[model samples]
Target: MSRRWSLRGKEIAVDDEDVVPAGLPERLFATDRFPCERINMYSTIDFLLCVRDALNGTEEMAMLLRSCFGTLFRFPVRRVLMGKVIHGMLTRQVLTKKKYELWPVFGGNPFRFSLVEFGEVTGLPCDEFEEGYSIDYELPATEENYAYWERLIGPDRDATIADLVAMVLGDTGMPASRKLRLCLIIIVDGVLVPTSQIQKPSLKHVNLVKNIKNFLAFQWGRESFAWAIRTMKPCPKKLRQKTLRILGFPLALQLVAFELIPHMQG
Candidate 1:
């Protein structure tokens, strides 16, 4: 016999022997519960697009970026759809020990997204790489790293995403190589694996891109997928807050949803 269950007012049929996951909530949050006024999700699409435009007519610089970023530089930004998918996934989230799962509101089987899927969807490199290349791997605090940070940012304070955008867009007479490095950092810290600090570009990212070849070889897909998973993990304090701030790459999640759920394209 099958039993009907209501989750946030949506009814679905379940087997009599089916049991809810141990840590899952009895009632999922309503799909409409996300408040537009309170949610602060940031995107760097405009900044990146402007940078792309600025590089127009410069064949050499453009080719360099294409070689490094692949399709990530061309990732389309659909703000509305991204928000909807992110909210839906968060509301319907199912927590597990290893990874997180999302139960589609449209009544499909729960699914888990991993680095492999992320790489497939984004066309980023996902192969195993050296530990030093990993996003989470902190570089040693050396004078060279400090000098690089100072050259890009400043001597006094940490630079924010807004600051990077200005430098990339403005004609500060920066070299093509330096600008290219900055652009990659903007993509990673500003868009792909953003944190709650208003998408502040990490100094580590700045250091990683110093060697353009090595930076391009890094497994960005794996690191980004891991960051996104970490961001979506259940948090009691976050759930209680009125202003919800989501970290990581919600845009990637939206893209994956479009591929997996064909109906979402409509």
Candidate 2:
């Protein structure tokens, strides 16, 4: 049977019950429950299906998210109506590789997801972010969204985010994680900023940035994103002449959420 549930204002028709089905897809259909999850699984399997070593057959990645991403929410999974549109699930502590909150009181980027630690949280100001990056109020405020997303990933259970992620995505070799880290390299020229000090970008980062729009356009495979990237050239100038483009916070958050699948496959 099909049922309609309004998830964060978007009307979604869920098939069968809300239980995230037990396995990755043999093939994709219109009725997949977790839309983004379904597509990611499909893409991963489809792209790397033939390569045996590339994937961890029985212990696949999504399976890991299912097993390790425990139920922190109090309500029964079945009892819940619309799934909470977690605003900063990517930026929240549990999702972080470091397993703790480093939120800046001055309102940091709530969606900044990384395999390891955040560059820095809020309140403590840094010169690098103020000079280098820019903020997009475009991504919705995550304060209200945090209630539903509270401890969704269980940050404190004595497992490294990488280990659990490897357990979840079944990436025993951990290639994707490495690739993700590489992509996350901020290309700043001659600034000599220490890796230890990172800051929140307010739409303009100093030194340099990544060609995030182009990267995201390829990753999401959405025309709208490509259109927006092509049409919008908000921050054009960079300190260095040879850099590609600046990576935006929103896309960086997405990279954390999706991990290195797109980087590996695409």
Candidate 3:
């Protein structure tokens, strides 16, 4: 028997023969170092909390973040379980050609983690963009782009995640617009679509945020979800004996676990 599954607007047939056993024992044995290191959202959440406190008695905070990142602003920061999230990553099985679905065994039962589940859990945008719409394409790389980059990172070097955090927390003298831009940078780089090299922030993201309105309207959920799936793609042979670094927002996975598993809600 075959079942029809819809993922990210595409439909496919999943046959019983095609549903392979997780075969996790063999994969786990092949890799001695399955320690998963993922980018945490704590710093971003903390910064937002601080911003909230600072904007008490005013609607500026809402005006700044609500329109663009309403879902993220409402994210249950305290409920994230890193241990459970890492366990899910370690046992994840890539079961589809689209690579957007993961089936991870927990307590001897498999749970589905797919784009649809991720969007539902995190409230992130998951609709496929219309043709010719690109999320990663930044404004033209000109003097204007460099000027914004310089303002954020300075003229001498690329800005690291540490640098962005420092700006978000310490750079109080900056104008509200600049400060909002900086916060967006940190949130996107530090929490949403981070790479293993957590220090080096992407200039593409910086340039994209140059126009705040466009940045806010862009479908970040789709981009972030795609990055997470790409990072989670299994490559046991190449990753043997080395730490596995997970990219994208792992907090979503933790939240999903909390919802699906009763005991984990605590």
Highest TM-score scorer: 1
Question: Which pairs clash (backbone N, Cα, C closer than 3 Å) in model 1?
Answer: none
Candidate 2 vs. true structure, TM-score: 0.20
Mind giving the per-residue lDDT tens digits that candidate 1 earns over 73-110? 65655443665567666665554444543333345345
Better of 1 and 2 by TM-score: 1
Rank list by lDDT = 1, 3, 2
Worst 10 residues of 3 by lDDT: 24-33
Q: How accurate is candidate 3 locally (lDDT)?
A: 0.62
- Which stretches of candidate 3 lie above 4 Å from their native place? 1-60, 92-98, 130-144, 238-240
Q: What is the lDDT of residue 126 in candidate 1?
A: 69
Candidate 2 residue runs with Cα over 4 Å from true position: 1-55, 58-143, 155-219, 223-242, 246-266
Q: Give the Cα lDDT of each candidate.
A: 0.62, 0.23, 0.62
Tens digits of per-residue lDDT for model 2, 1-266: 66543312345565463323444222211222222210000011111121222333434333322321111111122321111212222112211122222211112222222212121210111223224323231334345433222223232323232333333345445455332221122111001111111222111211112333322222211211222222112211221123222222223223222332234213
Which residue segments of model 1 deviate by more than 4 Å?
Answer: 1-39, 78-80, 94-97, 100-105, 132-143, 154-156, 235-237
Q: Which ten residues in a row have the lowest lDDT in candidate 2?
A: 37-46
